[model samples]
Target: MQLTFDADVEEFRRKFVEFLDEHMPAPGDVTERSKSSAHVPDWARRWQRLMFEHGWLLPGNPPEFGGRNATVLQQYVHLEELSKRRIYHSFNPQGLGIIAASILSFGTDEQKQRWAVPILRAEITAALGMSEPGAGSDLAGLRTRAVRAGAEYVVDGQKVWTSGAHDADVLLTFVRTDPTAPKHRGISVLLIPTDTPGVTRRPFPSVCSPDDLDFNEVYFEGARVPVANRIGPENGGWQVANGSLGHERTLLWLSFADRLEDLLGDFRPRTELDRDAYARLVMDSYALRMLGSGALAAAARGEQDTAALSILKVLGSEASQAASERALDAVGIEGLTHPAVTAPPPPLNIEHFSASWFERYLRSFAGTIAGGTSEIQRNIIAQRVLGLPRS
Candidate 1:
């Protein structure tokens, strides 16, 4: 019932703030470079190396694996602080958030040695290839096939929306390996090297923007991956994928909650958000924070409520939409003209927030669709939370 940071977490925040103040790039540095620079891998690597050296890259990773072995509370503090300052290593999410943690839990020690440290150091980049053009939200319907052949599996299929596939070194992909089993039961996950002979990647225009945040269409024609690369047993990948999604714990998707608080806190009288509007923002923000905290508390104690995750997704998505509307109203027409609205928001650039208001609005709209659609979330609440009949 009592949701608050302990003293240790507060101390960690103070130290983290100091580190950022001293070593973090100046806001303008990102803006200037992004305006003229090409997609330079070295730039991202250099920045990631700096954070890694400071043991700040993945605070939750074990110390031996380049993490601080931070407590859950500490991790929450770090993320919240980073959100407040608008500081985060945007490139590491697919790797650190999903892949590395997965390896830590499911991979052999040898596999961990091969992948974990380099990933934490940001020396390697990875992508998630779970969504196919035909199989998105309905993951079980995936058609990408990986058939066992001697010590390797021959893969053949196409994946769409493979973010960063063009440059990523590897992909954590789910492929169908058994047609006889039921849909969810027939899939398996693999760590595939993109440089394999039969692999081809073609860039696609981002649904959001063309400048950055690009997704790709990746083709696999008899791509051979060692059997050692499989994450879980053949036809048993559903549990692995579901476990990973559950690990996200809803908080990851609700990052908008913190942003909403920031936007609402910065609101002024001239921006056209009425006093009532501001008050509603305050109330909604507080309510979300409490609900999210309770969900986390339940999760940490091993009594996670599926309905809470569904509720958080729905409320959080709606909250983000509401907050975006208010932020645009606060900045008046200026927000509409911001750079993210005009083009891709500059990576790591905090100064060019001009188009970010609108860009964020566009991006956050996906919050409803990404993890699960709002309609799907409602169905989950109806059946799982409300105990309703399917018919």
Candidate 2:
């Protein structure tokens, strides 16, 4: 893969930067809530639509799906520019980036026409219905049942930690199609609409914010999705899931890099000790940039390696967590208070730092646990990357 951009890419970059500068949300409005992975805010949705109309929403998708069929390097550059600006391409990443990519790769032509185009156009939100009450990182152990009844599958199960399930239009769901088969062998993916009868959702608020309870518990009882909605062959959901996870891990790395950059810009030191801490934080971020570039380079190769993604996941999440922790310590008591609460005044840009990062430490920790936990990443790295034996 080429490390340097050609003249065409350089031109694309120049225009993209200008586009972002003209369209980015005013500084104060830029926050995690606006970029919620599960919930698409009205403003953010509008932004997505604007990009779609201009053929910039899903640049890697085909022109039939409103993308320009951009090259891999162009796609990579797009992600890098968005991260540099801390701008998310779509609020419903579960729908567009991860699940849609899976559908494009594995879905039947009809299924792709039905699902992929709408997803790329940002016309619907979808939640991944992985991570059952008991399955989680050990997804093959999932017990969610989908009994084939004629032309449809009657799904009955519960999905926990289903981010944005309440707001989603559909679920790219996994279920056991042949329970008597080996654990991984029976699994299948079904695209179930959220409004199907017998589907229910309950929100679970986070420590990060009361208004943003992005996680939910979703229940399915005899909810039927058409057999045609299945992405791959029946009892072949694991392959689809692996493809989805690769896309997800790539996004995780990019977002972590973006957040770390933002944290550095927002860091403010009031003491000599704080200066020492900030220095370490900057150095760690610099190292992470190099590590992150390696991951991007891997993606640019046009084929993903799960082992490589596992390595990047471990490094990126830890680097993000470390930065968040340092931000809290840098501000001392001010970090404990809400930015809206009454508090002592900070000097100069310190106020900006305190306000932006007051609750960020908690958010970052929660984010690390999502997608795949740090512990899970370590296991992947040890077993798959290092060829370590399972004791």
Candidate 3:
């Protein structure tokens, strides 16, 4: 299959590049910011809204749902360009790219009207409640309970590694509705407001830095949410969550592929990435882009492409980790401790990059761990793609 962008997509890329060059933040102008949606600044909110108003935020979304109904080729071009420029689309990128899209698949008409449009409009942000304190990779094993009580479902549970919970207005939460059912069954999804009476949250440390509140721990103590807020049928949340995970994996591969390219561009000459190693990494990154493009193509054609998503996640996440290793090798010891420094301007201008290398290297492990672990992805590829038996 053809790999490079077609003429139409190339032209589309040119237009978007010009638009981003006009609006994206400059190195000096960029504020010191945590990577959390919780710490969204006024400028970030405006920037997100600006992109949304221009029909640039959710390019692949349908027009009825506030997207441009963009072709898959266009979607690939859009994400790659954003990554090339190192643009953070919004503080709530996950909400727009993953959560909102999932809602379209599983939400009721009222649910769509209430949440999806506002998310696309950037009027509010959301967080995912997937990983619990005890159940990280084994999501089906979560113990959080939500029992239906007439008009409301009273929820009581704790979620950890919940990114941006502090700033999120709503949560796409998974809970056990039937304790007697199988591990994967009897679970349900809830669209609960974060400000509910029994809800509480606290920040957690990450390798990005000790003080960085990138992850959060959220607790629900008999949190009452309207029964109407449920996504899909009761005890059928596993299916809805599966849909959300598909969107998330697709977006993650896109983000990581672009980021790998940008990282190379940012530190190629300064870091000690030798010719052979650099070429290898470049090819690996190219392969990732190709896989990502394939996934996008399938999506554009309204296909699931589960195998592609799983393959891309496994390969892309490992490639990023390997790329980070090379970057660290180039930086040696200095990057491990130093947290800020001036970068080469213009052609190689990478703001917040000089002293951020090792820290980024540390955080890169999360890529492999989150969105289903590398081991899990491998099992998926082995079992689903290769049609292997569950040994």
* 146-219 per-residue lDDT for model 1 (tens digits): 99999999999999887677877888889999988989899999999889889998876754555764578899
- Scanning candidate 1 in windows of ten residues, the lowest lDDT window is 31-40
- In order of lDDT, best first, we have 3, 2, 1
> Scored by CA lDDT, what does every candidate get?
0.73, 0.75, 0.79
- Decoy 1 TM-score against native: 0.85
Candidate of highest TM-score: 3
Q: What is the TM-score of each candidate against the true structure?
A: 0.85, 0.87, 0.88
lDDT agreement of model 2 with the native: 0.75
Backbone clash pairs for candidate 2 read none
Identify the superior model by TM-score, candidate 1 or candidate 3: 3
lDDT of 3 by residue, 160-188 (tens): 99988888889899999999999899899
User: By lDDT, who's the top model here?
Assistant: 3
The reply for model 1, stretches above 4 Å from the true place, is 1-3, 26-43, 265-278, 300-302, 326-352, 356-358
